[model samples]
Target: MRYFKGVLASERRIRCIEAEIERQQSRLALNGVEGGEQVSRTMEGDAMERGFVKLYDFCDALDTELIGYVEEREAARRTLDCLDDGDMVEVVYLRYFEGLRFPAILKLLNAGGRNMSERKMYSLHEQALCRLWRVIPREHRQRKSVQ
Candidate 1:
């Protein structure tokens, strides 16, 4: 569950960083056009350079976050694929990958002709996680042994 949650968190953080970068660029562009600050040329250059430095920092952070997100998401997907139960796979996929809460998961399941209660969905989620935990260690050992 923590692993799955981390992927979602990373994705959200990346989006926030991207939006901030865009805002900073827009503000810097507007600064050039507005021409109302009435500061010295050197001060203006300093401010602009600082803004770009912040933007570059954000871009670097975003690149790092994106790389981690892709690797984590792929590992999570591979783990999910190891599960034999389609229902369990769907539940995990919707909750983690799709970032849906329990209520939304319930709604989608029911819409797909699954007449399941919230409690049942919760139970299934627990079962899926339990299975995932068991599978992960075994999968890890298998890879290590092969190498």
Candidate 2:
């Protein structure tokens, strides 16, 4: 859950950083020529150099964080896919990946015309979490030994 939430938050942060970078890039391009700030005009090349340094640092951090978030999300998705039950997989996927609330997930899952109560959905979610927890990294070692 933490990893999934982090992925969503990281995506938002990444987008904001990218937007800032784009804004800075275009602004820096016309820094001196256009209606740039008085400070920029006074500093000449120094202000522009500082702007480039700030943009470069932001890009580097954004790249590193984005990569880490993507890798974590992929690992969670793969782990979720390992569940034998399709219902469990769907529940977890909708909750974590899609960021749907319980009511929304219940609506989607119960759309097959079956009368699925909220309590039942909650139970299924708990079951899915339990199943997910069972497939830990140490369990992989056990499976290998058994094999």
Candidate 3:
């Protein structure tokens, strides 16, 4: 579950990196523009071409990683769906997808004025986890994640 949340964070990081890459590329493009008084030499053009190629390769790699993160997140959500209990599902989903802490989840779960104790909350969490492993099959649990 932690892995699922980490994948989301990695996606945000990839977006930031892509923005930086675009900024760098725009800077490079501005640099490529020849001054009105001067013409671009062959050697200078070649250098600019080489730099853009490297940037293109980097951008392609980042795009691939972003796709991988999206795929992994979907897979984790499917795994979470395997649980039979709605409350259990909510606990796992909120924990992983929303990145909420246990105390926060406890508050959310207790919103109906049920007045659940901390110990009971912990017990519910534990039971949910136990059921999660038993409910999800071996192969599903072994699926690889990019995070």
Worst 10 residues of 3 by lDDT: 32-41
The candidate scoring highest on TM-score is: 1
Candidate 2, 69-109: lDDT as tens digits: 78877877888876777877887788878888989999998
Candidate with more favorable, higher lDDT: 2 or 3: 2
lDDT of 3 by residue, 49-80 (tens): 66666677878879887888788778677876
* lDDT of each candidate versus the true structure: 0.81, 0.75, 0.71
Which parts of model 2 have CA positions greater than 4 angstroms off?
A: 26-42, 111-115, 137-147
Model 3 clashing residue pairs (backbone):
none
What's model 2's overall lDDT?
Answer: 0.75
Listed per model in order, the count of residue pairs whose N, CA or C atoms clash below 3 Å is 0, 0, 0
| Cα distance off (Å), candidate 2, residue 133 | 1.0
Two-way TM-score contest, 2 vs 3, winner? 2
lDDT of 3 at 144: 42
lDDT of 1 by residue, 62-144 (tens): 99999989998898789887778888888899999989998999999999787998888888898888788865634333222
C-alpha TM-score for every candidate: 0.79, 0.69, 0.59
Off by over 4 Å in 1: 33-41, 137-147
Candidate 2 residue 19 Cα shift, in angstroms, is: 4.1
Model 1 TM: 0.79
Candidate 2: residue pairs that collide: none
